[model samples]
Target chain A: MGPVPDRPATSSRTPADRPATASGPGRVLIAVYAIFAVAATSRAAVQIATRFDEAPVPYALSAFAAVVYVLATFALARTGPTWWRVALVSCSVEMTGVLVVGTLSVFDRAAFPDATVWSNFGMGYLFIPLVLPVIGLLWLRRTRPA
Target chain B: MITGYAIAVAACAAGVAIWAFVLVVLHREPEKPLLMGVGALEALLAVQVVISVVMLIGGGEPGSMLTFLAYLVGSLLVLPLGTVWALAERTRSSTAILGILCLTVPVLLLRMVEVWGGASA
Candidate 1:
């Protein structure tokens, strides 16, 4: 309700004085990540539970993508050098997963009769899966401990 | 899954989504009106959940009942959770988070409708 406080000054004063990963802009990022985490996890759960036999590869990949998103969300929310490193690794892996799975799903339509979160670079999820890790890596870089 | 109700919910969500975006553009945090709007959307979602449950119990079997129920619960959750996250810090980013939350409602609703219709057919 009060006037927006000046944030850049405080953030700049102590480069080592990094805010918690869940604070400020990071909060928004984490929220988005949390959404994806829930979405992918649930979708994977349902697919694997009910119809894993139909498309095991895509369903398993969905589960894998869910796990990665969950880890990324957790690592991004935590504070510390270790957690930061974990986030970096998780996002990198996520980037690689999306690209690889997305490409495969695109060129070999027969291979993906069922869509995973990374199918076609997450076209089903509005391409957020494709873009989220990029933003996450940038955020992690900006917030890296100095 | 009801068409009229879905449309109503989407309209409410769109109104709040725009309000949240305007707050972000103006570099303002979410204030009372915005929070109230979220609260209103939450109320609508709650109503939706109840209606959905009633329909399910009344032999309105969706194609995948578990999936439909999960989405119903998820739709009810997003606004409250997003509001808590947004209120944790009063900043433009917080407002932007609210906007994103608002936008998610319609997507969830649309998916719910798809699942419902898919089951009925």
Candidate 2:
């Protein structure tokens, strides 16, 4: 196979000329977000289908996280001012969700009968979920994909 | 997962992962060997999935068949995902998308083994 790259090499460009959010390091972010999108979606599907009545809060939250992950994945991968802002908003929501849900899950154990991706600030996920959006927002800011 | 086969897959993936990582660390473009190595590793993963499918067809049972199947299917999907990564600019970050993906297979296999051993959900 030819080693052709879709975009030209970026070694000569300054940070200010960074292309769309889906290129360069943004590709890595998309890779990770895609993983979480699948992970959270599948987890929620199983929980909701089998045991929704048992613990609706965490299950619903899992689904919500899944949607956010999906949205963020697309928003980051797609190019446009609109998608860039969508990614920004989605990452903000993700950061807030993880922190708020994480704190609540800690302070009130009874509230969350089971764990969502954001539970305990994603402690169960080795806290990658906690860190992903933080990096995502920063990446978005730094790139400011136009 | 047979202990030997698991070890083989993990070892192969480790070599590939390290190579990919070294490329990232050194800020090098993906050379022929590394991309070919990914192709080889993917073939190994495919064999692994086939083995699992055979075991299931032969009456082996995982605790949660759905989850087990999902992991199996998901494991095979890394190649397609890599296609996207490959088509992008061969930047260090772009290359790392595949490198990070190489590490997931062993984890997926480990999780599959747990499910096979009757861990649920």
| Docking level of model 2 | acceptable
Task: Give the candidate number with the greatest TM-score.
Answer: 1
**DockQ values per model:** 0.56, 0.38
Instruction: Give the least accurate 10-residue stretch of model 2 chain B, judged by summed lDDT.
Output: B83-92
Q: Please give, for residues B1-121, the per-residue lDDT of candidate 2 as tens digits.
A: 4646866997888778888887777776677788788888889888988888898999988989999898989888976676566545666675677688888777778888888889877
Q: Write the per-residue lDDT of candidate 1 for residues A27-52, one digit (tens) a residue.
A: 89999999999999999999988989
**Candidate 1 colliding pairs:** B63-B119
Instruction: Quote the lDDT for B102 in model 2.
Output: 82
Please give the distance, in angstroms, between residue B17's alpha carbon in candidate 1 and its true position after superposition. 0.8
Q: Per-residue lDDT tens digits of candidate 2, residues A52-111?
A: 999887899999999999999999988777998999999999999999999999999899
> When only chain A is evaluated, what TM-score does every model earn?
0.91, 0.89
